[model samples]
Target: MKSQGGHFNKIIINRILATFLLMFVAIGIAMFLGIPNPETLLLIVLVMITSIFGMESGIVSIVMLVLYVMYFYSAEHSFLLYNRGTELAKVIVTALCSLICLLFCSLVIHKRLSKR
Candidate 1:
């Protein structure tokens, strides 16, 4: 039989995987549509989806999304984008927006969950 801790860990893992997958799909869609500012809205959506499972998952999803966006920008620009101040600022803004959305959504989720 599985211990309670093991089951909890499994849920956490599953949350991470699900968040990652959803973010991947969102990113892909944005890219396919040539949306340069997709994160502005996509981050909110991603956080909302992850927060359904738990606050931690919502936080993790935003963190992972930020990292992925950073890497993706570097890759798409052949690493030259990092040398531009405006581009770097855009990345920072994106990360901040994502974090802010995650915090707001997670708090709402926490409050809802606690009421049960």
Candidate 2:
């Protein structure tokens, strides 16, 4: 049981590291490609991470993505800029959509695994 717990911790750490690495790589690629809408790419990355690493990682990814956009992409490069109603709305909507996608993916994965 002790060994099982250690193994589970190791797996969780690996997934978290992988999620962070993937997020940075996606951001780099978006910057390199000069994508007009980098959030779209980030959203795809969020979905992929959620599907592969499960909801915990998905939630982390969503928070990271939102913070990245709010800080790095904002005109003032600060999270406090959300005082603008439209900006706040966009972030809320994006986060909600990411959560919906994560839930849908988790349900599909659960159903598939339960069948086998």
How high is each candidate's TM-score? Answer: 0.78, 0.85
Candidate 1 error regions (>4 Å): 71-80
* Model 2 misplacement above 4 A: 82-84
**Model 2 lDDT per residue over 26-68, tens place:** 9889878988667789999999998899877887788888776
lDDT per model vs. reference: 0.72, 0.81
lDDT of 1 at 34: 80
| Weakest 10 consecutive residues of candidate 2 by summed lDDT | 68-77
lDDT of 1 at 39: 68
TM-score of structure candidate 1 = 0.78
Candidate 1 lDDT over 2-113, as tens digits, reads 8999999998899878877877787778778887776665776666775676666677667767765676566365644575677677678888887777777777877887
Q: lDDT for model 1, please.
A: 0.72
